[model samples]
Target: MNRSERRACRRLRVAGAGVAALLALSACSSSDSDSSAQLDSPASASAPDKLSGITVFAAASLKETFTTLGEQFEKEHPDTKVTFSFGGSDALAASITGGAPADVFASASPKTMKVVTDGGAAYGAPATFARNELEIATLPDNPDKIASLKDLTKSDLKVVLCDRAAPCGSATEKALDTARLKLTPASYEEDAKTALTKVVLKEADAAVVYKTDVKAAGDKVEGVDFPESAVAISGYPIALLKKSQNTVAAEAFIALVQSPAGQKILSRAGFLKP
Candidate 1:
């Protein structure tokens, strides 16, 4: 009876130990499975980028260079797009202050940018990215032998000037004041591009515009640098709008504009660095 009882007790103990070991293994397996699932969860993975696209309102004088930069930005981002509205800086500022849906604003003058900032449309302080100076765009050649700013005052010559509200026009007026000359334009274009177009199309013999505009026109018009232009230089400022739908993308574009590559593009287009 003693031997059989002892062996039976040992068998019971062995069976119970086996069951405990099996339960322990199952608990370890369950824990490891839970850990693996958590490691692969969406929360643990890297977050996706929030950048998509943005709309930019810029000065007409920046059309060419900004267009080039916009294309480059799209290419680099792949998932992003850049849309631009180029016009008079004052008009653009007015549009922004009027609640236009834009992600960014690049004004030809700090005064225009102030319009946006003062209206609470700007996200932060506008940064000056480049500068521009006045230039006289002639009809391909000096047909009237025009050499200086005063020569544009000839009554026989038809000259165009940007409207007084525009940055280009303001700069032109400053130049004229510096020269102490009083000359009326044949027409007042709303923007520098339009004023330059007048001469490019021969509608006017000459136009007072930004050097960048004259350069962007290529050989369509000849550029004349006057000493008074130095006093009439305008600074180009860029800022993110307060109503921007894509803040991340807008900031990135601003960074690109202030970057070395963007400055190089601006320089190629005859813009002065800030």
Candidate 2:
């Protein structure tokens, strides 16, 4: 080959090699840029893995429904655990105000919930999630033939009612007042479950308690709905405690209780919608 032709071919080959090197360098630079960008991006960050435990102080009437919801919350958040303290709403409120460590408070009545709010123990305004009506819970087959509220007033019939301080008792009182009838219970129980237990254990012929408790008793007790119950429905309220250490988890639980899924569970447990 002639010198000029050979020189031109060598130059062309050199130029081709340089172009290949530049392309390779560009690709490497682009890849490095992408890696850096991803590292700096918030969207590429991993989710938090911290464990969260929440303590909930709920009313006796909410035991079944809240327990079901707590189980679901734990299942949805594998890193979370829910602990419950269930009892009379007024008592629970007193505990919270007395410096009990709790993340949430679910009360059976607005009056009890107000105890916490008025004490400034709540993080925010409480939300009413459910309502409960009064019912007469009697032994299986209702041997006492307790078909109405007045049946409880009949002499010689052993009847039990919640304490006036309790939400269930307060509701029962309102119901009796609505019917223009007065009742003298054999005893005043501390909570609805305790009141209902009187009939379940056959300790008393009948007990005025929340319908939810009666339903929860299954075949253990028969529920008698009175027309007066409409006027005595108790509103259930829930709120995050001001002293909550795990606010995130507590808020999530509150959201669950107010969600459609949670409402369905409460409804299935015989609780009314707020």
Q: How much lDDT does each candidate structure score?
A: 0.90, 0.89
**Which runs of model 2 end up more than 4 angstroms from their true locations?**
1-51
Candidate 2 C-alpha lDDT tens digits along 1-274: 9999999999999999999999999999999999888655433322224536889999998888889999999999988899999999889999999999998999999999999999988866899999988888888998878899988899989999999999999988888998999998889999999888888888999999998999998999998889999999999999988767777788889999999999999999998999
Model 2, residue pairs in steric clash: none
Clash pairs for candidate 1: none
Write one digit per residue (lDDT tens) for candidate 1, span 78-193: 89889999999999998888989998999999999999999988766899999988888999876888899999999999999999999988988888998999998899999999
**Candidate 1 displacement at residue 64 in angstroms:** 0.4
